[model samples]
Target: MPRDTAYLQIADALRERIRAGEWTAGARLPSRARFAEEYAVGQSVAQRAMELLIIEGFLEGRAGSGTYVRGPRRRMRIPRSRLRRLSGPGGRDNGGGTWQSRSKARTPAPERIAARLAIAPGDPCVVTSYAFLSQGRPVETCESWEPMAVTDRTPVVLPENGPLKGAGVIERMRAIGVTVVSATEIPRPARADQARADLLGISVGDLITEIERTHYAADGRPVETADIMVADRRAEVAYEITFGP
Candidate 1:
């Protein structure tokens, strides 16, 4: 190892110690000076090692106090394959946990959303916002858009209204003779904006996962697009793939 990589090596050693239960969760670590002396490294190197662990979520700093191990993270698994299932008569349960939603109708689609749905900007769309919860705590939020051109007068026009309220995109489209065949998602790491942070009960600039999802029909027409946000500390996204013989 190079001389400049000493801090990283120290971080690795600290991480190993943490996993081995040397200092269990909520246990305070030695002061930086003590760490430097124990590891035979300079104070700056020891500080860098501590900083690395903090970023990696292994440890947290308390104001006017020393660093301590973080408790185990809480995580909810979101299965990608389950997005295709509909909630209706004889439909299988989505198992996405419980959720609550509020929706507004006749909202004009934003430019970026228009591009995703392949519709003209400013076109009228039904926007439904959702907040998913676990044990009464907010875990995820989603903003879904469906162009009025496809569902203007249909029973499923508004996602949270009419008989098909709370139904999935596949079921809603199928009811209107639109056969949804495919769905795609693009996920990226992001920081929580002010509004999202408030909704998810997290501080601004906290790490989050943003997923852009789109549903399509058999005729190659776009059915719906949505932006989903989950706090990194609360959920984990997983994809399931199967090979055909």
Candidate 2:
């Protein structure tokens, strides 16, 4: 916790405290003025600390309501390439692809997700959310889901636990005995919401990149679906189209 990094230090300290259950969810945090005095720092420093926590999803501030603890953050990462095979009720590979299981995670569904999955707005789905970091800083927050029928199997295997190298989702699934025949990708732009802003440490009005993908297997069966939001500043998806000469 260097002096110049005081705000981040304060935020990290508070984050740890919140995660440790010292400050329960919905518990109001100390006022900026109070924290300034408590920390023997200027009000600006205290305010910066609050902003850091807010951006990191540890705190939420309402218009009329003061800042308070929010529940655990949700982060998701799915490789763009691998085709995960759909497993039957018994978790055996059915020679068809399947989406990731819900049992591996617990996160809230974003409202717009249903449209991407072609499900009714209120329909229940299996969701997996996670954050991707490359250095110590956060890079992107991803939320992806599929109908339960597609992901009922337990322990959906992913690439070995270490950091992903050149392999993408397509390769990992193939390695696991699944094959992908086709994929469709759609792109859109959107205003950053509180959750997105917090996860990416950006402001509410910032532009974010949204990608929706639907994957199909050999028989044209929809095996998996995904919705991903990328921080515009940090990443961009590129592709090269080719035609036979």
Candidate 3:
């Protein structure tokens, strides 16, 4: 059998040690040069091994402090089934607390958002930015868009301004005589940008989960699209599917 590469071997050894509690959470590991000498590999290989562990959520890098075993992640389960339910005033009770949101109306839809809403690139839309918090700590952020063509002059033009403020997409559309039939979410792993990092209180380059979500009316009209961002170490998304009998 072909032997494992140097980095993989080193990474595996480190992983085992971590799992065995040789290095407890918050304990710093030796420098790359030291690890290379201990593992009989080049420093670059050791660095690669450390990077792998960081990406895998087993370790973290602190600028000028060195690498350390990551503490247990604080996770909140996001139920896909509950997303369609109408939320109370502030926002949905995410088992954390009432979510808070700030909104901007009459904003011109960005090109990508317009495409997602099946409208022209520069079409007017209402944008609502949400910061979901748990116990006063920011946990997730979402920016949602709705084309003006669908909600112009309607009571629901501004999502948060409507009488149904804080309601979910399906419920809000229903109030406007639009029956939302389906929703789709596509999630991708990403690195936190400067703005997001500041909002999330994490360092830039921290790992994040980005989800692109779209909701559609029964008539196949696009109703809304949103970009949701969550810190990797702060939440875990759970999808609950129920099959029809």
> What lDDT would each prediction earn against the true structure?
0.78, 0.56, 0.77
Cα lDDT tens digits for candidate 3, 123-235: 88888888887767777888888888888888877777769776677777788899988877888988887898988777777778888888889989888888888777667
Backbone collisions counted per model: 0, 14, 0
Cα deviation in Å at residue 128, candidate 1? Answer: 0.4
Worst 10 residues of 3 by lDDT: 82-91
Tell me the alpha-carbon RMSD of every candidate: 4.9, 13.5, 3.6
lDDT, candidate 1, 64-165, per-residue tens: 577889854647676565433234211123255677888787899999999999999999999988887777777778888999999998999988788978
Q: Rank the candidate models, highest lDDT first.
A: 1, 3, 2
TM agreement with the true structure for every prediction: 0.76, 0.45, 0.81
Q: Could you tell me the TM-score of candidate 2?
A: 0.45
lDDT of 2 by residue, 1-245 (tens): 35688887777777888889998999998888988887777778888887667655678765556888876565333233222211211112212233232223333345576555555666655555545554445455555464554433433432222243124445434553557577777778776788788877765655567777766656565555666666654444443354666
Model 3: per-residue Cα lDDT at residue 180: 84
| Model 2 alpha-carbon miss at residue 127, Å | 2.2
For candidate 3, give the lDDT of residue 7: 88
Q: Give candidate 2 misplaced runs (Cα > 4 Å).
A: 1-125, 154-178, 243-245
